[model samples]
Target: MDKLQYDNLYKFLVSLGIVLIVLPVAALVFLFNMEPILISQADYDLLSDFSLQMIATRNKLTSYFISIFPWVAGILTCIGIVVLLIGIFKWVGLQKNLDKKLDAEAAIQTLNLLKMSSAEVAAKIEEEVKETVSIEAPTPPVSSAVNDHSSAMNKYIEIEDLCFNYFTKRYANKYSFERNIRMGKYCYDFIGVSKLNNIDLIVEIKYLKIAAGNSRMIYDVFERVYNSGVNYETIAHRNFKCVVVIVTPKEELPRLENIVETYCKAHRENASRIEIKCMAEESL
Candidate 1:
């Protein structure tokens, strides 16, 4: 039965037991008092001995009741124990149901992840953009290519040899790679002291074209890196550094440096904290 129905049934049983136990005591009391009124005067003399013996017998019965009172208490205690065991069993069943629900949710998430395609992922990205636009916080704009490059760079930064040398030179024992770590989600780009010490870093290289849009893209890259560092600082309590390196054609180095300086200042970060290095055209 349901919990409420079972509770009501138990309550009815308890009430019935109380009534049954009290009725006999009340009857015995009444019977003892009625003997005096019911007995005749002529029979009183001869019946005196019998009445005395009857009274003694009643006393013995009362003694028996007193002795059995503990048994009634024991029965009630047993009922309480049974109720508690039933409640525990129900709780265990409920927990099992909850576990099944969680397992189903996990399975659904895995299936959704497997079914996701590039187009669908892009649509999800656009939806995320719209949602961010609706929020009060400033939304950082990132291009699909930049996003992909950033993600890849983050993966490269977690390389054992790279992360070890990167953090050991600065903070020494302050950071340990013994523990598993991740990028963006756990740590930011590989440039902030907080993130580098606490988590691994990502180094991204953006190849720029000689166009106005490319110049703007370069500026955005710097912004993305700075934002990543800011994000790490805001979330991570440990000390680390994430470095962003930009590789451009030899001719574009001067302009890139200027843009990097401007972007760093705009983001309220230091230029020295980031490495804007130029590499050979083929090297990039």
Candidate 2:
């Protein structure tokens, strides 16, 4: 049966049982203590029996009950007590089961809420990624007088955004990411913290100029990211990891792998903690 119905039924039964027990006990008490109020001794005697012998026998029987009133009360009271205990046991069992069912239902609701929140976050991140990708460079370059690296910085900034969002999809609701993280001397492109998984992600980005075929770019990019990761790792506790994303032309993929392999050979132990992601320039 439904828990509420079960509870109401047990409560009603307990209350009814109490009333039944109380009324009988009250009637017995009044019959003994307030006998005059119920029916006076003079009236009882005047209501004549058929014979004097019969009247004396009835009086003897009545006196016997009066003498054993305590024993009679004790026996009836024990029966009432047993009924009360049975009702109490039934209520307790019903309530305990109800509590467990309620707890289970609450847990299910919490899990569903987490799933909904994860879906919303995933949706928002996807929408922002599309917007970032669709944004084309301005016609005029904003101004001709800007710093030499200013254009370079502007060009690769969306690439940075793309990389951050890429991992955000993989991590989903498990981690929360922040961009332009400035802590401990150097500014990091992104930092993702996941308390649930006990993990921290340090993301660094390098947009390679594959058009110039700068083979030295591989060495420079790896060195820079490795240094930053080492510095971050100094203060980082356990479960610290790094991802270095390189945006390059499709032609330079082999060169990128060679550089990473060389680095890994020299530092095999730390290699497991670091990961690399290479992307084609056109894709971004």
Candidate 3:
């Protein structure tokens, strides 16, 4: 039977046992009080010596009850005690089983809560990065190209190599160039992971005079780097850093730095997670 049924049955048995034990004692008391004398005092004078001592001191009704009721009382008391012990033992076992079940359920719930917290942390980081890029650094249009396509491509490659070498030296064995970091529907450039502090790194090299819209490319690079870093952090539970190296002439470095400084000032909280550097083309 179920726990409830067993509990109810045990309670009833306990009550019945108590009644059985008590009823016989009460009946014996009543019988002794009502039937006090077993024989008449006048009859004692005529009786022989052996016959005078044959009868009980109490009444015959009490004597008859004493002969049969002692066995009945003993049997009832034994049954009552056994039933009470069984009920108590079973109830305690059921209670312990219930406690273990509750503990298991609570453990499962705690694990689910931790999973949800992990997802929220990832989502919050992604949202903050998106906001910083979209508001502080708006995408620019494809203006007239300042340099021819062939020369610009060669210059871009040289600068990218220089930046790679710089980071390789700085981060030692932890640096990677053109590593596949998957963002939404795209893979980004130069993703590195630092084991020392659990830092996710994204390095981008920007050459402004390219035939393509260099200003527009800057926003795209920023967004992709941040998203990729956030994705990595979510999975690995690491800190993320985005580094953008602008490759322009020495004369133009001041203007680009001013632009990056303006962006940083606009979004100070998000800016702390990013680094923007102006590198001269001559250095490449």
Candidate 4:
């Protein structure tokens, strides 16, 4: 275990041992040394010997109970404290594990972007515009290109890395991220994680353009992707965001954006945390 965890365990065990050892001994001491005030003060007033003996017995019984009750209460308090600590420890451990699904953190993303410059950003914007005027309608990915999209995948990953790093700058240490992960039936291209809380982001990238005629498919894809993001949030009791990316000709961005915005408006409730980014390959 890490130092933080080891310290917590050590403190809990020591507290438990102290309670177990000290309480009983303290209770016994109180019982043995307890003085019966009223009974002792009136001992001489009792005329019947049997009455005096009964009073003495009652005083001793009362003393024992007085000593034992507080000790029982103390023991209960200690037990309760231990139980609460266990629950809290378990909760922290669970939070730590929640982000384990993602191997990288926002700080790492930021470090990778340290060498990037303003010129690069300007150049990328220009590239996106040029790419838009160059390519025609959404054509099918060549069977060869479709065979292994790893190069395109790397391009999207690079863009996502930059986006996440810039997005989570202030809370860099409190977030984690991953790429090309399978949530369920679908594989999300990127995922952002929250370390301090249960909020995460899911991202999917498309290297081709969306057709206007594919509204049903688009809507269903959004629903499935949104649900996939929610699945992780539900399991970890965190909030989630769903993002869709399109790497198409720059001219086609407006059309794809409209389709996504329409779907977002239709599913406003679940789509509140949903986002779509339509860009050209050169932009990355």
How far residue 82's Cα lies from its native spot in candidate 4, in Å, is 28
Give the higher-TM-score candidate: 1 or 4.
4
Candidate 3: residue 225 Cα off by (Å): 2.6
Per-residue lDDT of 147-196 in model 1, one digit per residue for the tens?
74454334333332343454457554332222122334432222322212
Scored by CA lDDT, what does every candidate get? 0.47, 0.60, 0.58, 0.58
Q: List the residue pairs that clash in candidate 4.
A: 132-250, 198-238
- Put down candidate 2 lDDT per residue, 180-275, tens digits, no spaces: 644455556676665344356777776665424443544455566667766755654424577877776678666666666776787676566678
RMSD of candidates 1 onward, in order = 16.6, 14.0, 18.9, 12.0
Worst 10 residues of 4 by lDDT: 128-137
CA lDDT, candidate 4, residue 236: 41
Candidate 1 or 2, higher TM-score?
A: 2
Best by lDDT: 2
Looking at model 2, residue 275 earns an lDDT score of 82
Residue 182 error, candidate 3, Å: 4.2
Model 1 misplaced stretches (Cα beyond 4 Å): 1-202, 233-237, 261-273
Candidate 4, residues 216-261: lDDT per residue as tens digits?
6556666777887777565445577787766555776677778778
On the 0 to 100 scale, the lDDT of residue 81 in model 1 is 56
What's the best-to-worst order under TM-score? 2, 3, 4, 1
What ranking emerges by lDDT with the best candidate at the front?
2, 4, 3, 1
